[model samples]
Target: MDILLSAIFSSEEEEQYVLDCMAYLMLLMAAWTFFCLLSTNVPYGRYAMYGHGFPVNAKFAWCVQELPAFLVPVGLLVWTSAAKTSLLTNQLIIAMYLFHYAQRSLVYPLLIRGGKPTPFMSFALATLFCLYNGFMQIRYLSHYAQYPADWITRPCFITGSALWFLGLLVNLHSDHILRNLRKPGETGYKIPKGGMFEYVSGANFLGEITEWVGFAVASQSVHSAAFAVFTIVILRSRAVGHHKWYLAKFEDYPKTRKALIPFLY
Candidate 1:
């Protein structure tokens, strides 16, 4: 009887230990991600554009900022896999991280075209947010954070995927509209007038916020929820600023459109 009791207690202890370790690792990853985000933003601010024509100062800044952003994600990936030895979790994280990287590294840079560069501060802040999010997402994925096996079924996954994809499309389209609003040698900003833009002045920001919210719901993780909250706080501020800027700049700009949300904001 005594031996049986000892075995039971030991098993419980081991399980709890594993859970505690996982929690600690998740927190560590989140912290590193935050640091990388701040570091990345500092350099992103210096660059005039996405491509090679950036000034020397901007180039140096980019070099400095890029390191931690790359390192944090890579380190988390390696550590989580080693700790859990879970290939499925590793694959999920890598796939999601790659998807985001494709958008940031390839799509965003291509979209720059000949328009005036985004404000240095804007780029810096945005990059920081992106890096922070990127790390959080990858860490969660690597941990296989999910609802109970039966909680979410195929149908739910399908619906959630649709929402996520739609949000991404809206975000990309809104960004394109804003980028193309200015041609070479044109300086002033214009009110974006397409897609969700008709509904909200900060349609791009709204789209992105929606995108991550959808992701968090789909993923069903506290880490993802935290990321969504942070995104909302930052983007909401930007949207308000943009709303005020538009109102101040153009007399003809519609008063009906909200800063971020459509209709009910």
Candidate 2:
């Protein structure tokens, strides 16, 4: 497969074709996200909540769907080309991505005490996203991207990694708050508190957007940038929905808090 393709096409030719695929995919994602923002609500978790479809266990769905993002890169390293040209910077970037997914797919799912069932449709969509992004990021960084030997020591890399780490902490903490909001045998909505929740209605989303932005800054590739842009657009819209939902659901919901930021939306 990869071996045959590598033999068939020159390095430059393959890189260009793969990049074009990534760009097209990103464009479609952007268009779909825009449509989602304008015409439709998010189809999962509390926004649309329950819907028509075969339901899957939420923990199972999270583990299985998100596993691709965690496993695909390792598969690439094992089954496909092993880093077209090894660079510490590229490895570091991939490591950061895998670190997040490892926790998300493995740790997060098992920690779920009780959660609403997910529609098969929503699970399928999330699975597709994981596969797409997993392949794109790992493929580009491991094979196509050409980072400098000293790139890791660069200011942008250092800053971006710091931001990414900070965002990861924020996201994990926010999610923990939400997960514990309900006690055993309780199935009800409660306001998420602690960490960045004081500032934003969607602190988890804010952290995710921040992480992706940092990825773009560090990688400095169209692949990473596209993902970042798409994440921000979609999550910001979701944040807006969450903010509105909280206000409507609870009269005492803070009026001072913004959707995804402290002072400004």
Candidate 3:
């Protein structure tokens, strides 16, 4: 019995050590990405610089790049021996992460009215990030996370949950406004109005940033915090890029709209 208990504790410790390492790596990645993005635009979407690689269909690229974020967690839940579902808090947190990816990977791509082709380099990078972050988050929650019985009732959890849902609504509504911006056969860009777009040029990016921040706050884990920081680093740059593009593209662009934040950038 003593030997068996020692083995079990050793395994648990090893898992935890791995989780810590991965989380730290993600933090390092966030720093590196921030510096890299300072001088260069993110190599996809509206600011795509296509010389690095071939272009892929935007819808297909979205599905392929984002699928691993949803699928990897499902795979971990099935294969891991940890008591992931035994804790209600774990279940809820995992559900929230999965829910976001399910919509992003499966539904959002189909809903895109006319997305531009993504560069192969950008698609590959995004695919790699999805795999890494998906594993980091789900592995921590399903195997390493624990919470008090009243965790769900706590102020932090409540506030984070509210923020998460609000961000999701904003994100979905912003996407809706963007998809409807141009007529079916239209090709050029148009000013996105309504929803949070009235306040920020990158409403969708703001929503996504809010989402991961909420996830970090609710989970209260280093792993989730790393992910949130990375999300903010990347998306904030994206929002700024979009704002600049809009300003340069159209003389009539809204002068009052900020980049990522509302009423302030």
Best by lDDT: 3
Cα RMSD to the true fold for all candidates: 9.1, 2.1, 3.4
| Candidate closer to the true structure by TM-score (higher is better), 2 or 3 | 3
Error (Å) of candidate 1 at residue 127 is 5.9
TM-score list, all predictions: 0.65, 0.92, 0.95
Off by more than 4 A, model 2: 4-12, 49-52
Error of 2 at 56 (Å): 1.6
lDDT head-to-head 1 vs 3, winner? 3
Task: Name the lDDT value of residue 42 in candidate 1.
Answer: 20
How far off is residue 181 in model 3, in Å?
0.6
Scanning candidate 3 in windows of ten residues, the lowest lDDT window is: 1-10
> What's the lDDT of the predicted structure labeled candidate 2?
0.84
Give the per-residue lDDT of model 1 (tens digit) for 1-265.
3244346547635644544454455456546655555433322222244553333333333433343445566666665443332554335434544554566554465555443434455445545755665565564565445444443455544455556667788888998898789777787667789899999988988878877676666665666666666667656656766787789889999999888999977
What's the ranking of the predictions by TM-score, best on top?
3, 2, 1
Compared with the true structure, what per-residue lDDT tens digits does model 2 show for residues 69-122? 989877877787665536788888888898999999999999987777788888
Model 1, residue 200: C-alpha shift (Å): 0.3
How close to the true structure is residue 185 of candidate 3, measured as C-alpha lDDT? Answer: 78
